[model samples]
Structure formats: C-alpha cells, structure tokens
Target chain A: MAQFLVEGRELVAEAARGLSALALRRDDAAAMEACFRALHTLKGSTGLFDLEAMGQLLHAAEDRLAALRDGQASTPGDIDALIEMVDQVDRWFDALERDGRLPADAGSIGQAAAHRIRDAGGAPVMAEEQPAQPSWRIPPDFDGLSGIAIRYVPRPDCYYFGDDPIAITAAIPQVTALRLSARVPWDSSEPYDPFTCNLVIEAVSAAGRAEVEAGFRLVADQVAFAELVPAAQAGSAGGGPARRTLRVDAARLDRLADLADDLVIAKGGLAELAAQAESLPGGHALGQALRLRQARLDRLAGDLHATVGRVRLVPLAPLFARFPRLVRDIARSLGKKAELVVEGGDVEVDKALVDALSDPLLHVLRNALDHGMEEASTRRRAGKAEAGSIRLAARVEGDQVVIEVADDGAGIDAATIRALAVKRGVLTQEDAARLDDVAAIDLIFAPGLSTAAAVTTLSGRGVGMDVVRSAAASLGGRVTVTSAAGRGTQVQFRLPVAMTLIQILVVACGEERYGLPLDAVVETARLAPGRVVPIRAGWAFQLRDQVLPLVGLGELVGTRRAALAESQRVVIAKVRGEPIAFAVDAFVDRLDIALRPMNGLLAHAPGMLGTTLLADGSVLMILDLAELVA
Target chain B: MTVRLDGAVLRLEGSCHLEDAESLTALLQTSGVSLVDLSACQSLHGAVVQALLALGPRVEGIPASPFLRDLLLPALLVKRQAKPSNL
Candidate 1:
C-alpha cells in the first residue's frame, strides 16, 4: 500500500539521518546497524508489494550494511560510500512516490552499494578464491531459545506511524523466525496507509514472554503477538509459512471511503423510496425486498470503512527507535552519562501525529540532555549518583497522550533565576524579592534568561527550551516543567491524539480575522490606550504591578493602525517565557475546523502558521505567536 | 686490423676512441673488426659503443673506460647472456 511505501521512505530518511550523525561521530557499529535496519525494512516491504527494483536496491544496501555490522570491514571511506548509497535509495523512493514507477537506472545505485561492500574487503581476493557468500540464515546448531516463541504482528500501516518494525524486532535478543506479513489482502484498486505495517515476527529467545512483550510494549496494540510452543516434529528451519498479505495504495483507500459514503447515501435514498412504495397499495412486498437489499449494502459499506480506518492506524515504535541514537549523541556531547528509558513506545496514535512528534520530541530530548542533566563530576559533587538518567515515558492520558522527559542532574536554581529576572528588568528588585523559589524558577522560561555566564556552541543560548515549547504548542500540546535544586528536572508534554481537526479561537485584528491557537492564549483583557505606560524603551501596562509588553496586531501583520476607540482590547499572549499583549479590534467566536496551510506564496508569510476555512466559508489565517516574537 | 678468409686471426693494434663513430664505421669497411680492447680507451660515448656492440662479433676489451666499464658493462653483459626469448 502507499502507506507502506511512505513508512519505508521515512525509515530510509531516519536511517540516513542516523548514518550521517554516526559518520560524523565515527561510530561504525551504530551507523551500520541503523543503515541495515532501514534497508532491511525497505527490502522486506518492497518484496511484499512486488516492487522489484526498490527491493533489489534495498537488499544490496542491506548486504553492505550487514558486512559493516559484522566487522568484516569498515572505514570512513566505506561509511561515506554507504551513506551516499542510502541517499540515492532515498531519492529513488521519492521519485517512485511522485511518479508511481521506478527510475530507469535504479539498478546502478544498488550496484554501487554492492561494490562498496565488496571493496570494503580491500583488494578483492580474486573471484575464484573468494569466500562463500556470507550466510544470512540462523545456524542450525545455535539453540539459545529457552523462552517462549512470541510472534509480533505490526498493523499493515505501521510504517506510516514512523515505526520501523524490523529494527524493533531485531532489538529483541535471540530473535528466531522473524517474518513480515500483511494483516489483510493486497488490493491494487484500494488505497492503503503507508504508515501501517503488518509485520509478524515469531521470535524464540531466552528472554521471558513479558520481556518480549515489553520489548514491543510501545506498539503492543497495533502489533498482534502471541507466544507459541515449538512443535517437537519441526526442524530448525527459520523461514515461516508464506502468506498472501494484502497491499493497498493510500489514494485507493480514500476513494474507497468516499465510495462507501456514497453507497450509504444511496441506501438511505432507497430506504425512503421503499417506505413510499409501502404506502402504495400492493407495494408491501417490494418495500420489504428493497429494505433487505439496503440493509445488506449498508452493512458491507460500514465494514469497508472500518477496515480502511484500521489500515490507517500505526504504532509509534519506528519513531521511537530513532531516539536511542539521538539520546546517546546528545548525552555524549553534553558530557553527561545518561541512559534513555522509553515507555509506552507501542502506544498507537494517528500516523501524522507520530511524524509531527518526531522533531518536538527530539528537541525535548536534546534540551533534557543539554540543560536538564548535569555532568557526572557535578552530579558526584552534589552527592548524587555519578551517572544521570533520563526517562522518556509516554502514556495515554484520557484522549490525549503525555510524554514525560525526566532527568536526574543539577536542577534549576531559583535564586539564580530571581537574580536574572531582576537583571533583565522583567521583574523589579522589589517584586523579585517577594517571589518564592517556585515562582522564581519559572523565570527560566523567560526568553534570554540563561544562567550560564558564557554561551557554548552546543547549548545555553537560551533559545532551545523556547523552541521546544513552541513546537509542542504548535501541535495543540502543552509542556510543563518541574525542577528542584540538587534533584532533577522533569518536563512533560501533553499532545492531542490527532492534528487534522482542532478547536481554535478566532480573533479579529484588522479587516482580517485570525485564529490564535487556544493552547497559546492565556487570556484576553480590555486596556485603554492611555493606560499603556512606558517601561525601559518598551511600552508596558501596569496590571497587578506586573508590566506586560504591548504588541499591536496591526503592527505585527503589517496593517495600518485603525482609529482609536473608547476602549481597546489586548490579547495577552505568552510567547517563550514573556507575556506580550496584542491589541485587536474585537474577539470572534471559537470554531472547530480542519486546519490547512495556505497555498500560493502567502503560505510563507511570517507569523502565519496555517490557514483554515470557517463555517461561513471564509478563510482564517492562523497566527504563529512564536514566529511573531522572533 | 686485417683478416684473411683463410681462417686467419687478427689483433687490435692501437688505441681506438669509441667516441669516433665515423672512424669506427670506416675501419669496419676495410676489415672485419674483432677483439676490441677498450682497457686504455677513455670516455667512450654511448652512441659509438652501441654501434660496435651491435656488430655481432665477440668483443674483447683492453678494459672499458672506468665509469662505463663499472656501471654499464655488467648490466649489458647480463642482457647479452640472457635468453632473448625468456626476456
């Protein structure tokens, strides 16, 4: 299905990112494993869809990566060559997605990848004397499976959710009989979700059933896994029975849904016609027959819609798989020894949400590593464990999902923050003196309030945490931080289950009405123009003795100032860590609508996040407050 | 040096300058040159000596010039003694 291919492409991109990062770090093992995971998934999935050209290229890449993984040979040059091969494969996948056909010269890239693998052996030992093809099969004598045989069946569209099933399965130690399959039949006419992966792996290992289940805990729902006892009559053969798994394209799935909806409407019309026919004399038999046919058709269409919807659901494991390397690199860069503990990785959300979460989660993890955790020496000096730990736990909280990033290191110092607040003039000396430690520590969220005296290239410029907050908020998510001095910092983000439909508050700025994301709006108030007072070159109004900066909506959107009225309403928006009040013409009612980005050149307009259509058929520009501040 | 067809032996009579290719060529016209004694010869040019060396007659040296005799002759002798087919 199209979803499968999309998921494969994402995996390839992720793998490419990992390879490039590792290539920079000179970590051969991790780079090779990442590459192998990507190519292996592509190869297996492509085979399922009978995409021969793509499958071949991926298979070649898999071989090359496998060689490096096994330490048969590896060098910086080899890594570069392999990375290039992966990039080419990515381009091919993109082209295929755009054109629905493989490129004419697709085999060359695969050939190049294979050549690198052979060349890595250094001066080919003449063809006749070369060793036998490296075996991919599990050895017959190897019997490490003392535990149960658990089969993991990922939903067919798992890939679109950014879950790399092969990588997750491979991470399970002593995995035996790993097989990928589709949950349903492949229909070229039907649209499929590319994110869905229906890969079932029958793994036999020394790891307990709970551990095996826990290994796939992040994708447990989408993955249908079962523990089975090995039959004594069976031999040591690794391959599982071949099943004809269904593959469908995504466009077709959409068409099918539309078709089903149309059929439902038709059935409704038939039901009404049947009632009319029954009212006529001697039409009872015809009415009964029409109703029976309508019922059957309705049931079929309902089943079709349900099946297609299931095909769209994918587990989040693939996206989660990419984070271990990210955490490792970041922790190493910060000179902090921290282990990433991920939970609820199997939790399935909509595929689009999973993809959107990747960057935000990465930013959060990076911030946790750079600013949340303290160095080992510092931790030891503070009488804490030398090795710090970061726990990234995710769970379904009601309709929303909460991902919590907790780190154990030197926590936020409230006194330092209070001093910074006074220095930055965000709070007067008198006000700062009255603030408690908890309130003072919140000042860290203030833009440009960094405790570090000197800014390093890695972090501490005071821009990272703000970016993290903005990114999370953009997805209708809120991030909250709790820290204790000498203890640690815990940052938790609560995000919506899906992004297609969102509730937004529409506000009028000038002639144009804009939707200020409800998540970012703290409150709105009416302020008289005369009440706006000057504070340190910036105009601020004294509300509760706290000076909040006044930003005019007209000025922000490049509109001419409107004539002053008796009273002006200012929408106080929290951006980064600072509060800025935007003067708007009037408040508009809230609406729930499908948020879509504007087309044409206007989509690139600054401070405009996206565009949405209102119930009255008018377009509303969604304002990005963070962009405005920047 | 002059030799009769009646199996007569001829000896090199005087010092000959290997650098003088014209004289060597003129000498070859009158008599079949044999037993070249290069011991007293000094500063033999490569061009004139190569001509004589290719004349297909056994070469005897009064001793070659010191630089040429030490550096070039041993290598030339090895080449000459080696089987051309093998090379």
Candidate 2:
C-alpha cells in the first residue's frame, strides 16, 4: 500500500509533466503517448485494491485521450482538463496516505471530475457504466488455431447484479483453451474485497460465432469477441543498462553512516595503541606490524565511509522537476510572462541537501516573479524581451554545489534598499547613508526588512530573503546577491557538497583537543620567544611585518587560558577576510569524522560548529573560527 | 455444508454460494489451511472465487465442473503466481 502511494504520486507527476508539454504543442506525439501511458498504468493499478472510483474516472480520461489520439480536434481546455484530472488523483493519493483510504465522497468527486474532462473533449457524459474492452491480442500459444476468442471484463458490482461471468465463459461449447487474469495487477498489500468482481475471464471456444455469443447473453455488455488466429510476436526493444535501486528508509542509511564513523574512530584507537607499543623497550617490530595493519584498516574504513556517502547522493533532477509548472502558473496568475530555464539538475548531491534546498530555491524564484519582473509594456520600452526569463541553474564547483536563481527583470536598487532600511528602522539614517552599495544591497537579508512597497500575496510578507539566508546558513552554506539597475538580480547559494561527514584538523589547547575545519586553516606557525607583543585588547603577533590579532583558543570557549610558552605554536586562519592567529599547545592528526550538530542546551552556543567523537571516546568540539572571532 | 475439512485438505464438495465467502475466508485465516481440494465442486459464486483469490491456499484437485476447472481455477492460480507489476 505504501509503495502504491509512492508510485501513484510519481505517476501523477509524470502525467502532469507530459500534459504540460502537450499543452504547449498538441502535435507532440511522444508527450501524448507518455501522458496516456501514465494514466493507463495508474488506472490499472487502481484495480488491485478497492479504488473503483479512481479506476472508473481514469477509464473515462483514457477514453477522452484516445479520442484526441484518433485525430479529433481538441478544444482549448482539453489539456487543462487533463492536468486537472491528474491533480485530483494526486490529492486523492494524499488522502490515501493519511487515512489509509480515500475520503467517503471520493466517488461523487471523481465522477464530477471525469464528467468535466469528458465534456472538455465534447463527449457525452456517460449515464451508464460501460466495461472498457481489454485490448488483448490473440494469445501466442493459440497459434494456427481457429476459434472465437472471448474476453469478458465484469463490472466491479456484477456480483450484486447476479452476473456470474466465470460460469458464463465455462458453459461455452467446445471450449479448448482458456486463460484468466485480473484486469489490473493484484496488490497483495491491500485487503481483498470479495464482493467487488476483479476478474477478466478469456477463453477460446471452437464453436460457431453465434453459439459463443449466445453463451454470454446474460452479460453481453461486458464481453468482447475476436476471431482467434496466429499472432505474430512483437519484437522486444533493446534493454538499457539496468539500474535497480533499493528503497531503503533514510534512517537506516544514517545508522549505517554512524557505524562507519565508529569504525573510523576505533581504527584511530589502533594508531594510538601502536604509538604506545613503539615507545616500549624492544617492541618496535610489533608496533610496526600494528601500524601496517592500522594503515590497511584505515584504507578500508575510508572506502566504506566514501561508499556510504556515495550511496546517499541523489540526483537534483527530482528536486528541480517540481518548479516548471509552479513558475508557469504563478506567471499566469500574476499577469506577467516568465519562463524558468533549469540546468545542471543531473548533478547528484546528498539527499539531505536536496530536500533542504527546495524551499529556499522556491522562495527566491517567487521573489523574482513578484518583484523583479517588469510589466510587458515596461520591458518593451526598456528594449528587453517582453517575457522575462528566470534561470535556475546548479553546478558543482570543487567540493561545493552552487545554485543560482537569476531573473532578467528589474534589478535590485541599492539606493532604494538603503532608504527602505532606514525607513523600516532596521538601520539608522546615518548608518544607512554610510553603508557601501554592496552592504546596502545585502540589507535585503535583514530580518523584518522587506523592500516590497506593499505586501503582495506572493513573497514580500516580512519573512523573505532572511529565511533563505538563515536556511542556507543552517546547512553550512551562505547566500549572496548581485544586481544591476534596470538589468536583473541573481541570488546564489553556496552549500557544502556533503554535510554529515567533514575533514578537520585536530588541535590541542592546554590538555583539551578541539577540531577546526581543514578548509579554514591557512597555515601553522611556530612563533619565536618575545615575538608575541602585548597589545591593549590582547596579544598581537607580527607575521611578515603585519600584526595579526592572536587569541588563545581555550580562552574563547571560557575554559582555562593557555599560558604563553617559550615558543608558541599558533594556527593562522582567515576569518571573514583578515588573518587571525589562535594559540594551541600541539597539532594532532588530521582525519575525516562525522560531525553532529549541537542540539538542546548547546544548540545556540556561539563560536561552535558542532562536535565529534575522538578515538579515546572523548568528545571533541569543532569550532567555526570565522564565527569564533566575529 | 459446501466447505468441510477432509483429513488435512479443505474440500468444497458442492456448489459454493455467495454466502459461503465469509466462512471460507474465516476458515482460511484461522485454520492455517494451506491446501484445498475442489474435485467434487460444481459451481463457485463470484464471491467465493474472490475469497479464494484473496486468501490464497494451495489447491490439491481440480473440480469436475468445466467452468471451475477451466476458467476460475486458472484465474485464481495465475493471480497467485504473478507479482504486482506496472509500478
């Protein structure tokens, strides 16, 4: 049942996409075939369970679609009607997911929807249910045979109507070969309904046509008769590479990832043991052998961790496929013309990142449509295309996935933002005036500072870009905006390719060891004695004739301060822009570890990114040096 | 009774009516009956066939009635062997 819901929703989305394509070009045979097949398959699946309402409705839709395929001219509303039918099915699936059955009024609602769609195609409303004939070819096993082929599809309520279809088929004279199948595949996951007739009874009878037809006299309306003859086998198409996938629960994958992480820590412990054994008297060979074994274990554990990460990678296409219709509908509703061109959706990223990025990407696109786009007349006067274009593109750059939503509409006006910031009391008038153009434009992300002159139904409610910015930041990513007057605006989100596991350089402060992100570390330095001079704020160190501010890592976390030694070992990291030096007792090994974000009491703790487990079962805090020094 | 236990096999000895569906489903569900014999069966109501299709148990014999033997049995057995497709 759960699988049905999942696949049903997917099929609905597929049909919607195909219908949208047909809406643009009715001559698209591929799109028409795709849409028809998805709906046909969905209707067939409905037969497995007690979803007779959906089955009947989809059957009507298939008839209407067949009429169109038969070269009947389509009315203007034909495509929209089909799209609406798909949407109704999608909603029914949502209800099925929640209540484990459709709503009580599903029959009436589905009937009305089917009527509307059929009417769009100028077809008469079906007053009495008609059993659609199953398009079965002559069975290949009955080659070179001559008989009357019968296919009987009983109505679901035929039992209540006193119709025993099997008895009718079995009573045929001179019956030679017979086969039975459900009109749709049966789903064992759902409880069976004995009262609903779900059988398709077919048989070959070696009798005159009149005699065969006479046998089904009681249920003639539900039977189809064909002359049995040799059926040429349809040639099979070449198969593509099989990519069978397992639908594992994401929580299970996370558990596997956690186990892999534990293995890495346990392997690190072996390294520690090897070092201890090496320092003992004449135990060098044993220590060396242990080191070799640890190295091999290190490679295997690393490979396991990487394999798990790869397993978690999901293509961004599904995340991106949701937008084209939304963009079209919003454009139509808002009386603006905009096209969303998406690219690089085939690039795979962590599944967690794909799910998290959906809302932020949507909000940005809405903002573009609502505020950035100019009217057609305005665009015409400005010598731009009448229809605006919004490009939502994603690409992998090094270890980060950069997604940008750019619109060719009126760009962000920095001066207007500066003025609005002061008017909204988000900044003082003097401060607003003093802000640079870049900084003033960034004020769009200030909470409660919306530049929209009036709140529209779409986007511009005080919670706008600030939410996008914060969401990106929570995922260890950042959002930036660039704009030009009368041209356009682009918002880019730079997010880590993987979020669960990260590389960190372990540093010791006094007796405590902390982890710093390897990407943030510029270089390590050993300072000569007396080179650290005392400044008013704190300690200052001269590096290449530039005095960089130095702070003890222990002092920042409110732990015991590190004592200045004869020679200080400091890590120079670039925070924001300037170089800052952090004094540490010693440099430990660099390793990839799973980082769990701080929750509960320490969730909002400043200057801390997260924590990880060390080899000796101790927790090591990983600091965000940029946030730490800020 | 149309349905009764014959040794280890559940047998349908006569025509099974619509009302027999409930008792057949209950017996299949409770007794853990894995094999059913239909040699003496004459006719099966649509409801009875639906129960057999739903609560599938291995069958031991074919009924004497040509309709139950040629049409209903094949339908029930084919459905039992095939997995749900078109997903």
Best by TM-score: 2
Each prediction's TM-score versus the true structure: 0.44, 0.66
For candidate 1, the chain B TM-score comes to 0.54
Query: Each model's DockQ?
Result: 0.00, 0.27
Kept native contacts, fraction for each prediction:
0.00, 0.47
Q: What is the lDDT of every predicted structure here?
A: 0.61, 0.80
Q: Which lDDT tens digits does candidate 1 get at residues B1-87?
A: 221122332333333232253455444534665444444454443323333433323444545444335533443354345424322
Task: Please report the interface RMSD of model 1 to 1 decimal.
Answer: 37.7
Question: What does candidate 2's lDDT look like per residue over B1-87, in tens digits?
Answer: 998977678888788887677778778877877688888888887677767766678775888877677656776777667634432
Best by DockQ: 2
Q: Which 10 consecutive residues of model 1 chain A have the lowest summed lDDT?
A: A231-240
- Candidate 2: where are CA atoms >4 Å away? A45-57, A91-113, A123-243, A276-284, A325-339, A375-389, A422-440, A460-462, A499-501, A526-536, A561-566, B1-87
Error of 2 at A98 (Å): 6.4
Provide i-RMS per model in Å: 37.7, 2.2
